[model samples]
Target: MRAPIKTTLLFSMLSLCMSCSNTTALNKGKEKLKARFEVAGICSNYTFSLIEGMADTSLVAASWTNPQSDSTYTNAFGVKNPCDLPEGLKVGDEFYFEIDSNRPNRCMVCMAYYPTPAKKLNIKVLEIVKE
Candidate 1:
């Protein structure tokens, strides 16, 4: 009886560990992209020039080009701020980020046209690369 219970507990723990590892595997392979926050009219937007790709792009083996086109997208800014982004993010602030599908976006934001894609993409900011 006790042995069966222990076996069940061990199996459950193993399953949990496997799930955690799978999530880590995803984060491990993803490469962060850099972009600068640009202020526009009533709605702010992003500006990404052909300036270049990133990290290992310089290597001859990899195609050197910007990961995303110029201003591929923007964040969903609500009455306060983007759902996941931190406050005080201003124009010309550069940061590294990745698309985070798991991150929920329940914030309400306005729609507007911009230089780039002008679309909203939920992202996880890896770090502030520059400003």
Candidate 2:
């Protein structure tokens, strides 16, 4: 009886150690993926009103409140721009926009939203121009 109890305790400890190791490996993989991909910014262009259109096309819209400042920016999304964003974005809102790397003046897509304002949002993408 004493021997059986000791064996069970040893097995349980080994199982628990293996489980912890697997969890650590999974967390490392997640961290690697996050580091490889950039989070352009939050999408701030899809507000509550514009959610219908985004839904029509199968897109997601959400509002976030800044924990630090207690300010809110509605409908934030991610974009590929890596610059000093506009004032609205500076306030912790993210803008989703499309850009043609070849043509700086043309933005193929544009979406802007703010949560507290509770306004309509629109996202438009221009047709691809053939060379």
Model 1: lDDT of residue 57: 27
Best by TM-score: 1
The residue-by-residue lDDT of candidate 2 on 11-103, one tens digit each, is: 999999999998886554232110011122244322221211222222223454534446443343333232323433232122233222232
lDDT of 1 by residue, 98-127 (tens): 656566766765677443332345567677
Report the Cα lDDT for residue 92, model 2. 18
lDDT against the true structure, each candidate: 0.51, 0.34
Any residue pairs clashing in model 1, and if so which?
none
Residue 108 CA error for candidate 1 (Å)? 1.0
Task: Give the Cα-based TM-score of candidate 1 against the true structure.
Answer: 0.45
